[model samples]
Target: MSPYDDVEQTGMGTHGAKESGMDERATLLDFPGADELMAAGQVGEPSAQALSGALARVGTAAAAEAAGRGTGDVAATPVRRLSARRRVLVGMFTAAAVAAGAVTYANAGAGSAAPTGTGTRGETRAAGAGVFLNDMSTVAASQSATTGKYWKTHTKAGDTYLSQSMDFYVMNDGKAYKKGRRPDWQFGPKNVDWKGLDQLTTDPAKLLQLLRTPAKTNDIAPFDQATALLGDTPASPKLRAGVFKAMAGLKGVRLVGAVKDSTGRGGTALEFQEARSLGRVTVDPKTSAILEYTFTWTSGPSKGKVTHDTILSMGFTDRIG
Candidate 1:
């Protein structure tokens, strides 16, 4: 019944799609099995019974775009087929729709549908998502370069008790550290080499290919790919714009008017909700840098469970733990 129910099976938990070579066994004291990535706000779906969620997300975006182009009510856009190019673009947006557990295609007609705008605000929300992302892309492209010997990010997740947290400080060599937890070096370090980040391009098409390549996980889920890309700020302004553009293209993504992060930082957000997983990425309007990811599980015992990974700062540093 809930829109977000489709995301449960492919948990945003610690177990990744298929890690490229990351072998770090992170210790989560209270929140067991929650993937550090998910804690950071990443993941997505399944059928008529299984694939509806993923398909809906894809169809919704396509249909909404179509509705906007026509004179009719958007609700009647009739989840239809996209052209070869659009189909391919849709695949890219949804990580080839791999989040449904396997790569599946939306049937176009029966499988997809867009949310009819509830009223003026709904129309505004739908349209605002597109414009907001465009604004972010513009901001990203206009920014200056920020690089150091290491790229650092602060990740935090808390429940009613003992707030869980860690610092991911990765050196240029790709080896990383958890500054908050002693034993600075992670055990059994997985090879986190992503030449893509270093050789990041401003071209959206090329960058999409690089980002979609399975690195952290074998299955290249676009949502995770996007989140991971946000893990470290792109080395260049163009690449940052590319990241923003790539995100704008995802199928079911939508905007929430205004929100404040756990740290009480206010900003705009975009999200994908399927089954049990609710993934949100918030951005600072002024800077265009992704501030953090927030995840919520809306069903089962984990219902109402929430997690957040906030990026205090991310850039190069000379040393690794």
Candidate 2:
């Protein structure tokens, strides 16, 4: 008979334990309880699948018990076969998988993952929203007249390039550059209103503050929003879910990503073959206040595919106190 014949033919005998172990092993082979394996750097898609299957079996047993149809022996079979550590690992993987699926479902117009803890969920959501709004406000306030600069650079033959400097000034009375008084070589037009350096100088710590703000309500900061804004589409539902989950607990003043370098010299601005995704925030590592943050997005289309390395950098300007 086949190796599995005894397993299939028996009820609960000497072969039962062996069969159960084999079943658990097979379940693990398919899903492998990613959380535990990942801790040991062994989790991947295959492990995820196996873990999912194992969880499904456990769930089936629980459901059967709830219906009063499952015997104690039947209910305990899977549990008794798997070790406690393996069970915990499977549980974690199951949670992650469920969360990822929930995100996809929510986005496709299904239920929500917004928790229902003792006002904790609402508080978390509010905190995340507040951080995002504050960061936006800070960035907006900093984009004023005296502190902004217009810089231009060009790359022609792989290694050789040229640079040009320009000054930005905003006039409230609307009379700074008149008809003939405009600069001889205008990058776009005199009407191209731009913020000045004085405004930028008002917030030296803005970048740091924005990067450290919480981005998620229950998990990590929203690295995805920054990535999406920079024009990178996430590759999978899991990735999308992970990113949104992360954003709920970020702490920062302003976070901007996907900056394209412009060369005003030519009519065509050279789009960085790969978009640069970066974040800036203040962070307090000791108290979790997030004194400074500048995590760069290193995965996606722009990584290692660009003609030249595009260094996207952000600096914090001190607030005008």
Candidate 3:
């Protein structure tokens, strides 16, 4: 026989032998009908021979007793024994299947085992840095408060000036407050109630010019300096450094720098180191209005460690009354 056939035969035979022992008593009960035939001597020759063989195998008395009990012990007893062995094998197979399935499920969800250096967070940071630099370059040029007008005009009233306003693009890189807005007004004569400023003259360019020029003590600075220093320009360094120094001493602050182009036409371009975290200030050579200022800063959770970079841009007009 083939090897597989040999194994199957051996397994079945071993199983059958074990079941046979358990069913011996039950088999005895089923022999009575056959026993009566033998006793009566009325059984056919073929039936008698078959009954004799079964009796010899089971023993006659045991079989007769089992049959009298009417328990269906002959055929059913061996089947019950075989079922018990089948249940054990089924249980073993089921447990192995469950273990293999669990292993496969775990491996499927494992993803790549190696660590990825460029994750979503890193990509976001990189994009943000590029955007920041571009914005900084623009702001540095805007905040210098440079003016082109040959004759600039100024007017002052008691603690108030012409209804003018300067708009600045500010970046609060520090994220110091809950909301993006923060308190940034300083009290002085020129501190026109923000609510009261005339709508027509509130141009950032005009207001910026007034702020930079030396003003009376009661006069408020024209432009919001903190918001204007985030630009690119040659003068950006001086303005940025000056503001940093000034901030050290003040609590709440408002500052303004006015510059005019010394030469009639706008020719000179502001210059500065783009990479360093410092301040730069530049002015229009002819108008003498501050044209741009750039401030670089670093702040974070670590003691004195920087967490962010930002620039502010300011603009101005010659219409200040």
Give the poorly placed runs of model 3, Cα more than 4 Å off: 1-278, 299-321
State which candidate, 1 or 2, has the greater TM-score.
1
Model 1 spans > 4 angstroms off: 1-127, 154-194, 208-220, 299-301, 319-321
lDDT of 2 by residue, 168-255 (tens): 2222233332112222221111111122211221222442243345433423233433332222211122222222223333333232
Q: lDDT per residue, candidate 1, 1-321, as tens digits?
A: 332111222233556734411212121111211221122122232346436655665567556655656654333332232223243334323332233333111112111222222223111212245445544665565456755554444445311111112233333334443435212111011222333344545676665565445554344346655665655443467666676776666556667645777778876777777666788888776566777788888898999998878876555444554
As for lDDT, the candidate ahead, 1 or 3, is: 1
Error of 1 at 315 (Å): 2.5
User: What TM-score would each prediction reach against the true structure?
Assistant: 0.47, 0.21, 0.17
Q: After superposition, how far is residue 197 of candidate 3 from its true place, in Å?
A: 8.2
RMSD of each: 20.8, 21.9, 40.0
Arranged by TM-score with the best first, the candidates are: 1, 2, 3
- Range of the 10 consecutive residues with the lowest summed lDDT in candidate 1: 103-112
lDDT of each: 0.47, 0.29, 0.28
Which ranking of candidates, highest lDDT first? 1, 2, 3
